[model samples]
Target chain A: MARLTKIKTRKKGGATEILVLVNHPMETGQRKNKKTKKKIPAHYIQKMVFKIDGKEVADANLGPAVSKNPLVGIRVAGVKKGASVKITWSDNKGESGKAQTTV
Target chain B: MNTIRRRTFLKGTVASGFAAVAATSGLLRPTEVMAAAWPKSAFKSKKLDKSIKNLFGSSKVTASKAIKIKAPIQAENGAVVPLTVSTTMSNVEAIGVFVEKNPSPLATSIDLTGATAFYSARIKMGKTSAIHVIVKSGGKLHVAKKTIKVTVGGCGG
Candidate 1:
């Protein structure tokens, strides 16, 4: 599972822009464990969903080919000042986490 | 044999030699040899919908063109490659990245609320793969993709 950090958002051209960083290894199952010499089962976050003011906005499909840590950026419109936006994600192992911000 | 028969045989031999030379020089129709390769089965997971909702707080997402993903055309090291995603929409919420050829597939997810529409980071690549970016804005989903060629294998191949 990945951990979210450095979440930030701002207004741009009548829309809101957001940036984020995540901490994760993003191991592909093709690699073998160093100690056991056994293949590590594929375990990566498969999907992510973004919501603004309780309205579903965007979603992404993930794969294991990605590097250790990743950063992402997004922009949304129609959000008023003080509105809240939420993000959630899940891995192949069913582990999930959530983060939120106020507009 | 007679003179006419001998002459005909010589002509046939010359024509065949010319054909062979042309084929070797690639002047003839070349064959496309497709490689025998398949995606690893372990990357396919059934929890696609669940993973999306878990990341975005909702299961609904629409594909859009507002997102732009930038990656290298070729990477010498599969262990690390620079990636950047930028968007131009308002009321943005989050961004996510994926590598299509990885065993599990999902690479990373990030939450964005009060920042710019640009994000940059480095990620590992086990092999050549497609990098995808998903952006959420104004209750809509935007997507983009780029192909990256990895020379080395990061998955211990």
Candidate 2:
């Protein structure tokens, strides 16, 4: 199966910054097809949660105005090396996707 | 008699609502509840002030110097504008980003837990406009803004 999300991390200001890239169209519903001239229905991730070792670190409520293929970075303090990280996201249409990584 | 009637009406409504959930989960209503939790009006608001009010309950905000916004002064492509917000504030509860020109001004809102008051994300700008980042800390909302010039709008074809 193709990965729907990718995570990368780096240390920043004494905290570990995790960058999550989710594969999504993020259609704004206002966009019109160049040739078809039909409005693209809005379909974007509405919520996402980032957890470390089963403990929640950040919870996001996103809107359709976010760019396609959402790239989000969050900083967590005192993150141990080799900590398991996971991101679960759900879209406006109730479809969900998830990805995991280790720091 | 009036109290009895009102109670009956309430009970009937609750029963139907529960039945709908039962049809899907048999008992638990995770999907329905999550779907209902998304702030509908907040994301539908077109104007900046209205969206700010819907998201944070008030447009009245204070500008803070402690907050830093790392975004380009100009975006060649409006579809993907990289933005990052980092702060030294303590007790940061939430962070939100708004685009003044998008069809829906509110772009993202986040709840932080055990975090270091930092967030980076990409947002679509409908056009050249001011983008605001609001940070909730110590029960007060602090804001920082940057104007990004977009050569092409991201909303339409």
Which candidate leads in TM-score? 2
* Lowest summed lDDT window (length 10), candidate 1 chain B: B31-40
In candidate 2 the C-alpha lDDT for residue A94 amounts to 53
Off by over 4 Å in 2: A1-3, B1-36
What TM-score does candidate 2 reach?
A: 0.84
Give the DockQ-based CAPRI class for model 1. incorrect
| Candidate 2 residue lDDT tens string, B35-152 | 3455555677888887776666667899999999999999999999999999988999889899887878899988888777988899988899998899989868899988999998
C-alpha-based local distance difference test score of model 2: 0.82
What is candidate 2's DockQ? 0.49
List, for all models, the DockQ compared with the true complex. Answer: 0.16, 0.49
Report each candidate's C-alpha RMSD, comma-separated, in the order given: 21.0, 9.4
lDDT of all predictions, in order shown? 0.60, 0.82
